[model samples]
Target: MEKIATREAYGRALAALGEEQPALVVLDADLSKSTKTAIFQRKFPERFFNCGVAEQNMMGVAAGLAASGKIPFCSTFAVFATGRAFDQIRQSIAYPRLNVKIAASHAGITVGEDGASHQALEDLALMRALPGMTVLVPADAVETEKAVRAALEVDGPVYLRLGRAPVPVLHGPDFIFRLGEAVCLREGKDATIIATGIMVSQALEAAQMLADEGLDVRVLDMHTIKPLDVAAVVRAALETGAIVTAEEHSIIGGLGSAVAEALGEECPVPMKRVGIKDVFGESGRPEELLEKYGLTPYHLAEAVKEVLARKQAACR
Candidate 1:
């Protein structure tokens, strides 16, 4: 399987969308090369706006463009796109429900040596809190392209969480992406592993490991966090009897929290979340950071075992 960074996919998709949608415009905060929005800028130079390190101003400009009937895709690092322009995003774009797509790149601890300040472990939490905001975390290159296209079709504001590190292309060319829908990657009756973004592929790996131990593990790709697939969460809880959620973000307020919130109300089950345990990330290689932070497949497999154990103990 070929590996491609989600940011690279976003750039290519945006450039393709530009050729189709004349109303589509792009805004970047002086990180076009890193964010990969330079691809779109190169193809559609006239439609690209370089806001020069001012994320707040970029959000405002995107909102203005959206108001003028233009579909604006604001590009920047996830930390700056969400943290630096939170107020602007909430007030300017989300408040009015503008058609602005915040294509945030370099998300999660995968930003690597940039360290905690650059790593966006809480961007999903921030974006998900905004009313009418659509939060999407594509698992790989194929999903990233679909997400970029889907964001354009959606009505309101969209936040696309993209990664700096390359990940295996999990889905095939025929796979269709639907917003607020969870795709079941694997089936099992004993336990369910729900994961979003880069963790989806990791969950698949964990499923294989659990299978070797005679534990049947179901895998779910919960790519959309804001309009979470509550039905899938409830189904996994009721059918599998246990659930384990994995993400590259903090376990406190990310995909894990969203799944817990839905299941807590809909159908409570024995569950454990695999992610950063409420701690900031540090400078390191992406793979090393993932292992140190316990975001690896081994950790997810262990989480599955722990949840299943709790499930059995409760029955006993």
Candidate 2:
């Protein structure tokens, strides 16, 4: 299995899109190297702008470019992109529904040594709250490229979350990326594991571990956080009877919250959320942070068993 960072894929995608879309421009808040937007800058210098550590100003500039009929992509660390420039994003772009792409990198605890200040655990929640803002969290390099192209097609604001660490390539050449649609990775009848971002791979691993124990588990890659495929979530709840949602974010308002909300309104069922437990991330290796925060495949498998037990109890 090959591994590649989502940010690496994003940079390659931007460079590829630049050739076809002349109106596409990129803006970075003095972190092009980390965000990987430097790839685009190298290919098309005239179209790239370095905003010099001003995330708010960069967003305003992106909004202006969009207003001028240019498709602007703002790149920066996820914490600064969503937290430091939140007001500008909300007022300048999302409020007026500007056609801008906020492609933030180094999102979630996977940021590793950057610590809690740099890690963006709530970016998804913030982006999902905005009206008409399409939020995407691609599972791997392959999906990241597909997501970048899909975000271009959307007319309104888009928030594309990316990670710093390399993850397994889950999708193949035939995989089609669709906005606001959940991809069913594996089929099972006992229960379902719904995941987004890097957690998608972990969910698949957990499902396989459960299978060895004779417990059939389905796996869903919910790449889109907003306009969340409620139909698929409802269908999973109705068929599987139990579900476990996993993500490298806070459980309050990420993939877990979204799935729980949909299940509550449509088809209620036994479920467990595996994510950051209302806390901040600490400085450590990516794998270490994941284990410490209970975001690993073992934790997801345990959550599945817990939810399965609850589902059986409900039937009794």
Candidate 3:
């Protein structure tokens, strides 16, 4: 179980993409080191821009570069790039459907010690609301690299959400990635676990634990947020008759809500959300906050059992 930081994978992917595409440019908001864009800067200084602490300016510059036929990747903290520059991204990039990639790092509550202000739990809801913006949340480091390359190939404005925590690489380097698609990690019939970002790894561990308790749990890697895998969600609902969605984002409008919305329309069943419950993060280690916020494997396993009980009791 090798754990790699998603930021590092994004960095390597960007460098490789830049090498292949001359039109690709990287821009950092004085966060080359934090966002891991330094690798690209070291490799192609001419194609990288270190815009000083000005996330808004960096976004505008990226839009301009894209308008001139250059694919620009604007790297910054998720909170600043998505929430702080909402107007710029909405009007300049997404409204006009520019070929700009918003490479947002340190997303979700994984960014510990920096406290609530730096944590970006609401980034998904914000970016998903923008019209014509494709939102992606990779499960692990290897997936992040694949998503970075795939997003560059997309034609419209895209939001690539990466994290700071070191998550286990469940997938191989040869793994294929497609935008707006979800993958079924584990198959079962008792219940289903739909998760995204770092939660996908935990959900897999939880599923194994649930199996030990004689409860079957299926797991889905919902890497894409905007064009959510509605077909997969519907299928899971039809097969299992229940769903438990887990994520590192807010329970209101992130993966949990997305899955619930899809299920509500077609196949409604017992549902529960395992994520941050409308709360702010505090200064602490990543693992501690995850435990406190009920994102651990045991918590998810327990949630699966609870939802299964609900479904069973509903029939009576």
Candidate 4:
């Protein structure tokens, strides 16, 4: 029931990692306060660098630090981190496979009141497109902490997408975080809901709602966007026969697209994608934006029903 922002967890994780990993350095594009990297700056000032609103330059610096054998974590708003500094990220870090961690905060439409310009609806697609780039979208504070540590173990570039709003803590102390693996939150036979980021919690809620109507629904927390757990996706498609993917991003190339791609190649099935319908976000409260963009649990539940109907028709 407790709620905490993923950015807050990321900051705390960075500070924790700094104690154990001396080579770990943090760089921010003058937005540490918003990105929550200020926590690390406060703990280890010498290791933190403020790039002064230059996302591209920060990425370049991160690449340089990485080249020098230092694990550099670049923090900034998701929009600027991916959109403003894309070339630097691609050329400097991802192209050469530098060990730079780009922990982008305030991702997706949850960046309420910032409007479409600040919101990063396409960051996942951009990051996923990069070769050897590990993309992670943690479901909550717990997963964010684990994801930060996991990203450190990875040898190549990593894009850790985080949200601004506080979300329910989904994982417990016993939960283990593995890169490129999907966590099955709940088991069911009728259908499965694959979700990433904040939508994972919503998918669980929708699954519970469907249970009340005697519709069994499985739920998967697809935290890793790239190197997607195709095995789990294929298993879900083969067993459940239907799937509904939900995310706080565009339907084009996010969790939905990843699931669809896997299903198409391996096990084809009836599916529905619940996300922003090729539209931009607006300035409003986080909850309001979610409802307006049809990213709520109700929308996910409706999508489940629609997919279920399609699955039944396929059998007929």
Q: Which runs in model 1 stand beyond 4 Å of their true positions?
A: none
Q: What TM-score quantifies how close candidate 2 is to the native fold? A: 0.99
Q: How many clashes show up per model?
A: 0, 0, 0, 0
TM-score of each: 0.99, 0.99, 0.98, 0.99
Candidate 3 lDDT, 45-134, residue by residue in tens: 999999888888888999999999999999999999988898999989999999999999998888999999999998998888888889
Model 2, range 1-316, lDDT digits (tens) per residue?
A: 9999999999999999999999999999998998899999999999999999889999999999999999999999999999999999999999999999999999999999989999999999999999999999999999999999999989989999999999999999889998999999999999999999999999999999999999999999999999899999999999999999999999999999999999999999999999999999999999999999998989999999999999999999
Which 10-residue window of candidate 3 scores lowest in summed lDDT? 172-181
Please provide the root mean square deviation of candidate 1 (C-alpha atoms, Å): 0.7
Weakest lDDT window of 10 consecutive positions for candidate 4? 271-280
TM-score of model 1 relative to the true fold? 0.99
Root-mean-square deviation of candidate 4: 0.6
Q: Positional deviation of 90 in candidate 4, in angstroms?
A: 0.7
C-alpha local distance difference test of each model = 0.93, 0.95, 0.91, 0.94
Model 1 Cα lDDT, one tens digit per residue, 83-201:
99999999999999999999999989989999999999999999998999999999999999999999999988999999999999999999999999999999999999999999999
Candidate 1's C-alpha lDDT?
Answer: 0.93
Error of 1 at 260 (Å): 0.7
